[model samples]
Target: MGIVINQSIKNTVITYIGFAIGAVNSLYMYPHFLGEDFYGITTYILSSANVLFPLMAFGIHNTLIKFFSEYKTEKEKKQFLGFVLLLPLLIILPIFAISILGYDSIASFLSRKNAIVYDYVWQIPIIALCMGYFEIFYAWVKVHMQSVYGNFLKEIGLRILISIFLLSVYFQIITVEQFITATMFAYLISMLLMLFYANKVKPISFRFKIPNNAKAILVYSSFIILSGSVANMLLDIDKTMLNQYIEIKNLSYYSVAIFIATVIAVPSRSMHQITYPITAKLMIENKYDELNDLYKKSSITLQIVGGLVLVGILVNINQVYHLLPKNYSGGILVVFLIGISKYFDLILGNNNAIIFNSKYYRAILFLGLLLAFFAITLNMIFIPKYGINGAAIATLISITLYSIAKLLFVVLKMKLYPFTVNNIYALLIGLLCFFGFYYWEFPFHPIINIILKSILITLLYVFLSFKANLSEDINSVIIKTLKIIRMN
Candidate 1:
């Protein structure tokens, strides 16, 4: 719990830093310098690369996190780490070779009548490899319980570099092609930084030794790779499918909307990084009661925070779209649906971590993969007609089904759930707060209106939350925050 708290604080700080930089880049710099087409190109390239990363890494990153603690000695850990490091090459090298060999066919298949993706297709494998090693090294650090630094580097450092790259384009120092190339360099630099941090935390030894658990590690990694691929597809298939069915320009609009909406899940993402190792440790020790408490508390806290973010987005979405180009305003509903889906994920708390760490984890992920397939199929069916909104609908339905399936599995198979009466109170208070703020228009400027509305909504939410005791944990946090601010 202490680690969760500390890491959550660190993650919150870094997330804001990333968001601040991202705000400047996305809101001002991207539109001002890159134009919407180039901006969309940038986003599409990264999303495409991310979708390929799981395949490149072959799931060894997740497998390492799950099994690293099982090793008893430094020598054993080093050998395990070495094996993990080497394992990706077996997949990435062949994939890269094939990509180069099949570049023409792949390009022809992907290039629609309106879209010309050939210029950027080559960068995908490079970005994938860089991202793959970054995750692998980051997991190396996570297994050592030094995740905060890695997360800061990942969440803040990478965005900061990208911001700088965008600024270069803004200053007329680089063409769109140069900016695209520089983007690959930024990822490489980020990966190198991860390696440097990994070395600083625990020097990587190149020793390889055969261990009894190596077979289990390989098997787990294989399944994890499949799971990671499915999860990545769940997140990115919409963008990819949209490219196939709609005009390329829509991808930029959808990407921006989705990015803003996904920010609501920041707290959940932050908590998951810390919770994963903790959940693994708990399961190792057979601490079901503490794990259950963690699950419930995390769900409520995440829901509270995520709900606030969702409310802010929903209430001020008009203002937000006004900040963007008029063309992107069409994505408002997309934002709403995706935002809700991400919040639903937040309400699940550490359900994913629990499932991944538990003995039944593989089966759970297999079920999730099946759900993800259905999601992709739905998107494929719907996006051609509904466009971005259809993508959002697919996401909403898939994520809802996925979360429910996970909950049911936890309840029936594990006999565990992450809900209580307080969750109901929190949900009710959140709805009231959203509704209360939704209709109340402030007599101020758009920015000021947003600020005032957010402050008032937060106040009402907090007041009712405390009155209802929706979360004892959050109540304590509010008290402590107030006390600290008062002292200041």
Candidate 2:
């Protein structure tokens, strides 16, 4: 818990930095400089790459985390790590070959409606390979119980580099075409840096020998790849499907709304970077009691933070969008729906870590396959009808259902529940804040109105959260914030 607390706080701060930069890019720079259509095209390429990443990595990233603890001898560990490191190439190389071979068919189909996408479609696999290796190295570090640097690289460093490329585009130092090329270059650079750090953290000894039980390891990695595809598809499929169903330009509008919504999930992402390996270790040791405690604690702690973020996004959404370009405001409903689904996702804390590490992980493959089909079906049906709003609705329904299914599986099979009185309190407090702040606004500049509203919401919400003692972790954070304020 101490490690989780310390690293999660650092990761949270860093994630916030990334989110701040992303907000500026999403809200202002991308829309203002790139224009809505190119922004959509850029987002489309990224989403395709992300959706393809789990495949290219062969799910070895998660396999590394889950199996690294099981090996006893350093020799065995090296063999396992070596196997994991090399295994993804089996998947990546074939995909690269196919992508090159089939580029014309792929581009023609994808760009039938949005011709702008055809020119950039080739970059998707290149970036996916880069991003895939990045996750593999990130998991490499996490298994060694050193996640802060990896988190910085994942959450902040990539975005910072992308900001520079974006600035280059903004100043005409690079063409938009070069900007896209540079974005891929940036990912490759980051992955190489992480590769260096991961090697430093735990140098993998090259063993020409494969790990014992290599068959089982490969089998598990395959299942994880399938399951990882499900989760990634639910996330990345929206923009891709939007390009398929509507004009690519609508994706830019959807991207802004989705970015605002994603900020609500930052705490879960931050904490999971550290907690995942911890959860893996606990499960390996059969420490059910401590694991259960962590499950409940993390659920409530994240609920508290995520709930507040949800409220803040919802309460100030209108004013925030008012500050954006007029075309962008069309995603107001998109933000709300996606934001709620993401908050629901946060409250299921450690559910993913638990399932992915447990033996029941394979069972998720079937459910994920069904849900993947469900997600795509819903998007196909709805996006054409409702545009980006339809995509949000499809996402919300699928994500909510998927989260509920995962929560039920953990509760039923493992007999571990993440909910408690405190989780309920946090949810209610968030709801209370939402209603209280929704109608209340300062009659001033959009930025001023959002600031004042956020401050008031923070004051009342924090006051109540402290009074109710919704989370001891959050209370500790509050105490530190207070002392720092006094010192300043």
Candidate 3:
């Protein structure tokens, strides 16, 4: 628990720093320097890669984490790592060949609604391949509980590189096409760095021998592929489908709003980096009491922290859009819908870790597939009529339903729930702060307004939450932080 808090706080700080850089990239640099059309192209290409990377990785990244702890002997662990490391190539090579063989048809189809996508369509598979392996190596570190350095690389290093690339474009040192090419190189570099660091963490001695549990590993990896694909599809399918239905520039607007809303996910993302392998270990040890305790604490803590971010975003959303170009302002509704959906997911705590590492993951995978289908259908129906807002609505509905399903599955199967009285108090605090401050504004610059409003909101929300004792874990941290401040 101490490590979880220590690392989660560090990861949260790192992730928010990344998000801060991303906000500049998404809101300012990309749109202003690259132009909306090219920004949309970049967003679409990355989203498409996200949707494809799962298949290319063959789910080995997740497989590594789930099975790494189960191996007791060093030799067994080496065998498992060796097998999973090579597994993705089996899928990656075929996908590369297919991309080459089917290039024209694939390009033509993707470029049907927007021809700008045609020339750059090939970058998708390359980036996806890079992203796939990056995750594989990232998991290699996570099983060793060395998540902070990986988190820093993922959360800060990549974005800083992108920021530099965007600045290069702004300075006319690189053309838009060059900027796109550099983006691909960025992912490749990230993967290589992670691989190098992973080896440093635990020197890899590839056994080149199949583990005794090869069949189980293969089966789990196969299920994980669908689960991973479904997860990615739900996230990026709307953006991909939007490319098929709307002008490319509209995606730029949607991307801005989505980025703003995604800031709310920082806490969940940070916490999951450490909690995931821990959850796997606890499940393997059959420590239900500790697992359930973790379940509740993770839920309340994330809800409280994530709730503040959500309130801050919603209250300041208009000001946020104010700083953006006028063309990007159409996604106000998108932010609200997506933010709410993200909040629902945040409150679920480590539900994903619990389920993904459990025996009942197969059932959740089926449900995920159904939800993916529903998301796509909803996007197809809604995007043509409602545009970007439609995509947000589809995402909100799909995600909320998916979160509810996961919560139910965890409770019914594992007899564990993640809510307490603190949950309701946290919700009220978020709502009260949002409604109370959203309509209030400062007669100053949008940036200044944002800063002032955020400070007031944070002080009020934190003070109230602390007074209410919404989470013992959080209150203890507050106490310690205060003590440190007083001592200083």
Query: lDDT: which candidate is best?
Result: 3
Which residue pairs clash in candidate 1? none
Q: Order of candidates by lDDT, top first?
A: 3, 2, 1
CA deviation > 4 Å runs, candidate 3: none
Write model 1 residue lDDT over 1-488, tens digit each, in one string: 77787788788778867877777777778777887777777777888888899988878777877887787899888888887788887788899888899998887777664446767789988998899889888888887787888778878888888888888876878887789899899899999999999999999976677678878888878878887887788888788777778777788788878888988988888887778888887887799999998998899888888888888878887877777778888899998899988988889989988877777868977787898889989998889879999999998998889888888888898877898888888788878877777777767677888888888887887888888877777788788999999999
Of candidates 3 and 2, the better by TM-score: 3
RMSD of each: 1.5, 1.2, 0.8
Models sorted by TM-score, best on top: 3, 2, 1
**Worst window of 10 by summed lDDT in candidate 3:** 202-211
* lDDT by residue (tens digit), candidate 3, 329-434: 8999999999999999999999999999999999999999999999999999999999999999999999999999999999998999899988998999998999
Which runs in model 1 stand beyond 4 Å of their true positions?
A: none
Compute the lDDT for candidate 1: 0.83
Give TM per candidate: 0.97, 0.98, 0.99
Each candidate's number of clashing pairs is 0, 0, 0
